[model samples]
Target chain A: MPQPSTRNRLLEHAEAVFRQKGFDGASVQDITRAADVPKGSFYNHFDSKQDLAVEIVHRYAGGTDLSPLGEGDSPVARLRAYLLGELERTEITGVEFGCLLGTFASDSATAGDRVREAVGEALASRSASLARTIEEGQATGAITARRPAGVLATFLVDALEGAILRAKTAVGPSTAAEEIDIALDALRP
Target chain B: MPQPSTRNRLLEHAEAVFRQKGFDGASVQDITRAADVPKGSFYNHFDSKQDLAVEIVHRYAGGTDLSPLGEGDSPVARLRAYLLGELERTEITGVEFGCLLGTFASDSATAGDRVREAVGEALASRSASLARTIEEGQATGAITARRPAGVLATFLVDALEGAILRAKTAVGPSTAAEEIDIALDALRP
Candidate 1:
């Protein structure tokens, strides 16, 4: 693969900075500094910090690896694999940073319409993905169908996001993992 | 009751401003302007923004009305009442603003140790309160003992926080209410 473009580099670094410092806390100058690109170059790529934020949400949402969920033999296994895969990603990002979607979601109210819409779409997509898998689980009799699959999917997303938030504040990733495990276990038939 | 003091007034207004704009987004000027107090008086009431944030977390945590949970006869009723009551509070705050504890939790990693600790303690207290209720439900055979009550409580808090985050991004409170109902239903034996 070829090297990432300057815009890509900015998105990559900006995502990390925004995750760590929040949308309001991370200035354009800070992102530029992190990307090792000139401040002027920022506007050359994205119109404003808000614009970059919407792009970042889109990029992060698109990058979620849902393949591991498909790899497992049973729906329960697939769901577990999916959630654990997410936990691994959280570990890679470090517990301190948490999930980008969640961070953005928390700040969405104050983040303006464009960013909020991006975040809303991103979360809705994620929940939909989870819901599809849950529907599969219900069909396979591996998960309870006590509630609608969409509701369960939303619950999963919420639990995972909540776990990530807790992990950010706690000492390590174990709290997050444990909390997630309980949530996944709750799905068992 | 007597009228709130100047410091109390600042704390109240500052909490709302911080909730609306986040800790980094809301500046001293905005907070003072909201409180209708001179800028210098801010320092007199609190050492710094971080100091005020810590106090806000404390006040918010202490003020959480777990009394509704106590009022219900069954564990499930108590849990539902507690969560619905929370939803009402969220409505009062407006879903756009989300939960203060969750908002702070998402920003905790970047918010420095004092703010992080305050948020952690506030969340932990909330989770513990929920856990005690869950434990009561378990003993009464109203909830399953499949997982430890503490883990279940954490899951509940996580799901609720996540729902609030979604509510902030979504069109209305119905999504939050539905998701919360599903999560509470999951607690059934």
Candidate 2:
């Protein structure tokens, strides 16, 4: 009912713009325009567009709901649920919007040091968590892949990102879920 | 031979800038600056920044040497060689530089319709070629997976793009080759 604070509004709008247009692709004016706030008020909240991007990275990574990973009894099944849940999300929002963390990963050139650092940490942390789950799966005999869990974890995450990027510009009816499924099946014993 | 033409110079430098900073991140001034040409001359060579980007997409895709795919006797090894050859390139250019086609794929928002079309066509064409090779591999029984060649091909290309993106923003020692190798092994019969 009550209006959110200006700072929160700025963050929400900035996230949308960043996800859609990437860090450098979207300008301060663009974010402010989307937020319907005066351009001058932008600097009042964030020091620079890059500053806003760093905050966004922190928030996006911190707020990610990994509860889907807890859905299934087996670790691999849970990982499948986690990944499929991601695809279902883009199914609702449209795949072209992309994930903010992934957008920043691909936009490191224009994203500057602070933003890159935040994205790097977020992606690394996510991959690390996935690796831990995969290791558990391996220990429990749910997964038979021989490669190190860390390696597989990183590969799977990268595959997800690649599928997302391809799906965004794809001319045909390619769904990221199918590509990711090919990956999940590969990990089976 | 005489010095390279101004137009050729713009194309080369524009490629460098776009590969480094992405389509929307680099301005016309940035291209001209990198090319050591006057800002006014940019319009003379191309109608606009987006126009030049489309041209770059065509040239980059058209110039990619998939011959490494012909390197080994087996189709899959050749594919590995081809993918490794791509990694060798970014190793020399710096992994942070990224592929122009992929940069455009991730930058579709600010890349405009024409650039997106060019990127989409190029990616589709590459994926199709990979699929054809994969079909050849499957016929020879080099690849064991039962997934359709088209699906497998799209999965491979998407995986490559994802590995590249992760390598760009990686904080640790994750190499694209290792991640890609994981994908290749997953194709084992």
Candidate 3:
């Protein structure tokens, strides 16, 4: 196996490359070049580009900081903070690629069934986490009672994904922020 | 130059292939094979893959049927018809590939600046059309005044895109329809 740092660097830089280029658009050569690693080193670490993509999905989801969802005083407040934190992460990373999960979702149709499953599960996991807070908000009367908390959580995540796609084309925060706020606002009583 | 029928087949089959495989995932060879045209004949019809993609975007957007948005009795009812019509279309077409416009939006990052602009304009035009209906809804008190008509229209489009992304993974209309309905419901006064 390659050194630990080389493996880490491959994951980091390849994520950026994959984000910039869809699964088919980006090549191992592009990823290696981005990571500044020897082209031959790629196979030594990953079985294939698809294998690397799956790993990247796992690592990206596992690495998200979800503490913001629990930090604020009210449930609605926490929900807003968690979502805005997501927006903040996208801006800081590179809205040009949008959210890595979303990027994967967009490319999942042809990236392989495994990639499709990975993104689907990742999106569902995030939605579940948000649902917990939304449920609390509904109980506390901070959110509306018309829709199920779980349904509302999925709406927020779905809208956020769409907004991220816009940010990819807009290459900025304004449009995405506006779209996300609309979903968040919809949760209100 | 190739015959008109050959050119027409290329467009129809290329849209399907690209919708299924994405811009980066689909190649001239793949498109030609699907269209049953010679690979070399591609260059005779278009300058490059990018040029073909630009034309595809224009054609896809131009081909959408927006009559459903205008046929219903009330503004809100018309909006619902339009959205449900979209759902019906996704079912009739391949939901596994989602909307062609959205597929391009997702792939636009690496596809090229021209493709990106093509998708951006397509999405904006659609959003603008939706906004006119929303404005009418607001005037008739079918939609809330809390947000501008344009803002609500953009939100609906963004949310719909996200739902379509989910359809790509689920390979069905159930989840996408539910997600889309939530956004439509949010527009209620």
Candidate 4:
């Protein structure tokens, strides 16, 4: 096992705390204290707490290997795989803070261009990947949607994020699953 | 128009700040200071910040009489009324703090039963009301959902909330409006 670096440790601990406290609620002191790093060392690693948050989101989303999702036999299976992975990850991490993309979307302070661009990238990438899978399913006559692949993918993402928001508030994952199930049914061949 | 009562002023200001800044971010000082109430008077009004937040969520959702939605021509119209009202209100407010129910959903501190129940009640009430609307729509052949009214309503609420989540984040009501348009099209007979 690769031993965790100081930077990695900071990122992991920060992600966990931010997931719990939110951007405004979280403080730099809390993160440093949680990570067992000297307060000054935090600045050494990242420009600001906002910078750290952006990196944390990138890591959280990328840290999950999406290969399994694409490996599923059918488009629906692939999409389900992606969503189920998200559900299990949240349950396990107890981070259940909602999707970082959606969370940022709900945030007003995220008006900074850099942060918005990063989140926009994450949203676009997820949507595009899902759209590709959906399009392939359509080619095979395995799925149908009144909206085009991109629009449907956008709706699915929107619904999933909303479900996550509800789940986060309700402190349960059941609604997220239900929402995904409905979206899947709607996209059925 | 009846002049705003002190309590109403406090609640209104608190709602705006809380939605814009969040529970931890919006301090009693900020709320009271905004409302021009004596700082000490805050304790006289609510038990604590958490207590204030609970009241805020209840007051915002409760203050609005749903009779307009309930009296719409059909279930689809009723549901649209509920959603469109939210969209318009959020747009006009320009605070874009996201929905109170949704804001809580993202905060991990809201895991407690009391807080969860408060948020859940708001959601459940909305969902039930929307289900009635869907039933009416289906009966009139204005909506063509194949699922039970309850299930379809749940989907619509979740999707609409997700759309609002995006809108709040973007600080633009257009996002929610666009998503609602798609949702409405889907429900068309």
Candidate 5:
């Protein structure tokens, strides 16, 4: 097996620490130590901690496995599948760490402009995906809606993130799944 | 006019700084400086910084000035009204601070159990209020739903909070309000 590239290794380590302690809470030393990389190597790999954080968020936003949402039979079914996937992720992580972007966004001090832009683009993309699914569902009569497709799509994404935040706060991943079902129920005919 | 009590003054200042800087990010000196109180006076008002933070959240959670969702309205309308009130608050503060309790709950690592419990109770209460409004809306037929009243209500609260977080990150308070309208729109018939 090919050894993980140093850049990839640095990003993986940064993500872990960033998730554990947030952008402001985590230090460069902590990140380098966690990555088991020398300080000089960390600088060589990334320009600054803030830059590394931006990249970490970009990587996560870039690589979310949204393929399952694409394969479902209907819009609502696809949305439910996506929510279930998030719920399963919570189960694996034990609800301590939530969406990395969300974790950083909640901290006003670390509200970096680039981080914000990346999140907005990612969310906008997700909203567009959901809108497409809703439109498909409407065209096929698999779903019924009186409002604009974009509105419903954005609502679903907003609710999912909020539900996850509450679940993480309550220390219960199951709550997030259940909340998603509530939104899903609304989408059913 | 009667002067505000010292304890109340501390709570106000702490809430502002805490919302902007988070638990670990805000320091005692910052709190005292903002309040214009002497360093020694801070301890005189509260047990510690953690104690003061708990009080601040408790105070904010209970201090919403908007009227409650009244009787006779459909639960959906009432729910919409309540959410609108919260959105209005975002505008009032320019969304500069977002939700204090949410900011706290999302970043309470340095805070003790008291602070966590205070925020949790507030969130739970907020969820319960929204759920009750949904139940009322279901009875009136002005709004329709597919899930149990409690679940829909919790989902609504979760979604709104997520929207606020997104708005804060995106630096567009209006986006948060718009996103909230999307979720509240779901309850309409």
Candidate 6:
């Protein structure tokens, strides 16, 4: 296959740096160095670090695998799979680095409104997707109707993000797995 | 009251700076500036930023009010009080700043082993304390025994941290409050 485009290379490397060092911590110089591209080339692709951050948020959110939420026979099973898939993805990406969306969200206060809004929108979209699944589960009587599906979906997202934070500082994925299990259990009718 | 100790003042300001700018994003200069002390004063109190960070984690963890977990007549009520106390604390501290332990934990991969281990220990201790309360709940028949108390405690911590992450970017505490309600609901026998 042909080599990756300059923009693709920058996005790929910049994501790792941002995930590892955070949006405020990672500078244009750092991104350029990691990408092995000159400093001048960065501006050619994105206007500012803030611009790059919004792009990264979009890229990361766009790539999230929601298929597990859609595929399983039962809503609870599908939700579990979706959450487990996230934990597995974090494991593959290196748990120590944690989630980019989480890291950015934590630092969004100082990162500017543009980046903050992008991260917010990305998370809202994820929550909406999960809400749809919960709605489906509620319709089938698989999940509890004590709370609105939208509310429960937001809770799952919050809990999953929280578990990832814990896993980042812990020994392995066991903590994350247990937390996800509890989150799914919370959804039972 | 007597003026706060210089060291205490430094820790207070440094925690806010770290929370807002992140560990990597905030430099010694920023901490000193925020603390209103000379750059030389920082060195006089601690060997390095990392040393100061370790102390901050200890202080934050120690200051966390687990009294709610100890006070109520019923185990579930006690647990609820404990968790709600935490949410209130986060609100007082400004959720926009998020949790310092969480903010540091996310960046631990590059923040060094000393900082990472200190944060990990702080969190582990907090979880242990919560687990003891959970065990108490289990023995009293106020909490389900379907899973180990230790497992449930860890999940509660994960979900709370995740909710804080969401509240940091959202408009108010409603989302965090709703999420916490669900987490507690999941614990019902």
Highest DockQ against the true fold, candidate: 6
Clashes of each: 0, 0, 0, 3, 3, 0
Candidate 1: clashing pairs of residues: none
List the pairs of residues colliding in candidate 5. B75-B136, B75-B137, B76-B137
- The C-alpha stretches of model 5 lying farther than 4 A from their native spots are A1-6, A39-41, A171-174, B1-6, B109-112, B140-146, B171-175, B185-189
Once model 4 is optimally superposed onto the true structure by TM-score, how far is the C-alpha of residue B80 displaced, in angstroms? 3.2
Candidate 3 lDDT over residue span B1-189, tens digit each: 856687788888888888888999998999999999999899989888889999999998898778977765787777767777776776777777788878888887788899888988888888888999998888989888788887788788888888877767773334666677678777878
Sequence-dependent TM-score of model 4: 0.86
What lDDT does each candidate get? 0.83, 0.81, 0.82, 0.71, 0.71, 0.84
Candidate 5 lDDT, tens digit per residue, B1-189? 998776767777787788777776788999988988787888887888888887788788888753557655656556667887886776576464567766776764435667767777788888777776677777867666566666667777788888877777654334565666566655656
Question: Mind giving the per-residue lDDT tens digits that candidate 5 earns over A119-171?
Answer: 66677777787888888877877666666677677777777778766755563
How much of the true A–B contact set does each candidate keep? 0.69, 0.67, 0.56, 0.48, 0.51, 0.72
Q: Model 6 over residues A107-186: C-alpha lDDT tens digits?
A: 87788888888887888888999999999999989899989998898899889998888777764335787788788788
- What lDDT does model 5 reach? 0.71
Candidate 5 retains true contacts at a fraction of 0.51
Scored by TM against the true chain B, the candidates give 0.93, 0.93, 0.92, 0.82, 0.86, 0.91
Model 2 Cα shift for residue A93 (angstroms): 2.6
Model 1, position A149, has a per-residue lDDT of 85
lDDT of 2 by residue, B1-189 (tens): 899878999998898899899887899999999999888998888998999999998898888888876555688787888888877776677788677777788888667888887988888888787887888888878886588888888888888988888777857875678777777766766
**Model 2 CA lDDT for position B11:** 93
| lDDT by residue (tens digit), candidate 6, B4-76 | 8778789989988888877888899999999888888888889999899888889889998888888757876
Docking class for candidate 6: medium
After superposing candidate 6 on the true structure, give the runs of residues whose Cα lies further than 4 Å from its correct spot.
Answer: A1-3, A171-173, B1-5, B171-173
The weakest ten consecutive residues by lDDT in model 3 chain B span B171-180
Worst 10 residues of 6 chain A by lDDT: A166-175
> How do these models rank on DockQ, best leading?
6, 2, 1, 3, 5, 4
* Candidate 2 residue A52 C-alpha distance from true site, Å: 1.1
Candidate 6 clashing pairs? Answer: none
